[model samples]
Target: MISYLSASYIYPVTGPVLKNGVIGIDPDGLIRTVLSAEEAKNQNIELVTFYEGLLVPGFVNTHCHLELSHLKGKVEQHTGLTDFVQTVMKLRGADDSAIELAMLRADVEMLENGIVAVGDISNQAISSGIKRGSPIYYHTFLEVMGFNPATAKASINRALEFKQKFEGFPLSIVPHAPYSVSAELFEELRLVAEELPGPVSIHNQETPDENAFFERKEGGFLKLYEFLGLDIGFYEPSGKTSLQTVLPMMSDRQKTLLVHNTMSSNADVVFAKALHPLLYWCLCPNANLYIENKLPDVDMLRATGVKITLGTDSLASNTGLSIFAEMLCLQDNFDIPVEELIQWATANGAEFLGISDRYGSFETGKRPGINLLDFEEVNGRIVLGREMRRLY
Candidate 1:
């Protein structure tokens, strides 16, 4: 049996930090045993040290838009959410070959960043190249958008057909966003989600604009609709809004994932958590900042015992797809522990996608789809110091 030992901090999610820890991985990728360095040394185990870098599990990004990969720096000039929406829609029907290349490149970028999995959102039209064995494992959330009941049926049918193309374990049909989808369309997706066996993801409360549009038919989105010649009569502002209205409509078997709730308050988070503590919140900090220019109230969300995870939206709204960059953005704001942050991007991400049984943790019998990082030095000297360089 091949056993690998490492002296790095182990983040198993439910215990004290095992300082100077040694984790053994047998021939099977599953973790054979996790022991202290001294204990492993006493047993004559061969050790490969990762210096001071924590040997945490690979990151799990819970949301991203791979199809928008080609528009890396194209939409930045747009002023508000509505304007940005127009810009994306304008490019809606692009050449198939060009779009495919950017999508493939974006996929490769995420894999290189130590991301073993993702919760990706798609219009389902681009359902050709994305599959299980491609770069990183993905839970494809087929998105649909329509303003009237007439278009709703067609939208839902297309989404369902697209989702069926994936004859794999990690995939599902889900809404695109709360605002873009009309209540009629949302209800249709709800019925589809009800029959789905897996979890569902939605862009809820992503911005104050989305909340305003849904709750009052006012905000940047209203202006965008007026400019685009889309009618806004079906809009009925529910003075009260949250996933509560939407969740109950979906299948009980499927867990709901609320993405980009940057506008959700402490009370909003508390109520949602109490309703379903298992519900997950996907924070696209970089994407939020890039478009609407704000991140979520992470402290409030975490305090509510809600599950929170990170995502690198896509090249459209982000410079690149890197879980490390996303986690660093979190550190730039929240005073969270390194291990917990690691869990948010790794185990928690995998669990949300319902693929935790395989790739999340580094244990025996699991696929070692593990990724190692290579640090870039500024001047032939490590910034963190040579003693604290390599990390598993």
Candidate 2:
């Protein structure tokens, strides 16, 4: 049976917004068509009017670390990324039961916030069970890391074993970050991607210290290696930015998502686009503020005309797992339009995670999971009032 849902405005994402729109959906939730209220009335169609909010497609969280949900308030805010990483490593192994429960709660919270799909990062198989029974679609990135070149092969073997535990799920063995991954490990990931194709997400330029270490071989990362009791004897500075040095090691054949990018420059962005045409820039603004008290130069990112997506990172680095909250943070700081933010949170993310066919827009035959972005009209300007409500 066909049903009609009417709203004041419907953002199709793929097409123009329909004013006083009526969306026709089948019993199974597939969108049949979208028509204006007048068009529906002319056809003598019944409509179920939702008196408030703008109807939109469910959000896609393009980057997340589901396993780190237990570390919500464990680490203090405004700590640098190096200290944050050290604290996580020290405190993340407290209790298995607690970690599992936290992951479960985060999954439910995202579903409640109208997150229809996720591109989650995992260093281990701890989140496998949660994703197995999760209502939200997840594309797991089996993240592997090793700063030492000698251990790169061993690290890939261990990652392969971890990936085996997550069989029957959409998984990709990917590098963790430029600071944590050696050149050999990146080549290993590229070779694995040749066998099983998928997009790769890496923590990129989260701090200026990362680029500093790559440029002149002197920075906080030197102290970080000392703190971890690791030797950097074989390591050599490339005299370039961290992203510029490491991106060459990545596969141009596969699509890549550069997460964070808190310190990425215009030259780096241009180099990335030239290196990999299928590159995507992911912004986790809240997480950037939490760790470094700063945000990426979003204006520069926008100026590049690069496809941008939004991510919540993890509870450890953010207050919550809501894409709407992330967007609000950007809006408050950057003054971006709400419509453009919606596209970043929804359509661009879906395309990156390879779930666009069913999740991006409310096109015909797509079950995009209708969402209501509730807002209050304040002095002729629309202000988002509350958390997003899932309508389907």
Which predicted model would earn the best lDDT? Answer: 2
Residue lDDT tens for model 2, 1-392? 88889887888999887878889999888999888778888888874756477899999999999999999988899999999998998888968899999999999999988899999999999999999999899999999989989989999999999988889998889999999999888888888988879888999999989999999988789988998888999999999999999999988877789999999999999998888888999999999999999999999999999999999999999889999899888878886766788899899999998888999898998988888887767677666666678887
Q: Which regions of candidate 2 deviate over 4 angstroms? A: 376-383
Provide the lowest-lDDT 10-residue window in model 2. Answer: 378-387
Where is model 1 poorest over a 10-residue stretch in terms of lDDT? 382-391
TM-score of 1: 0.88
Model 1: per-residue lDDT, tens digit, 105-130? 88777776777778888885574565
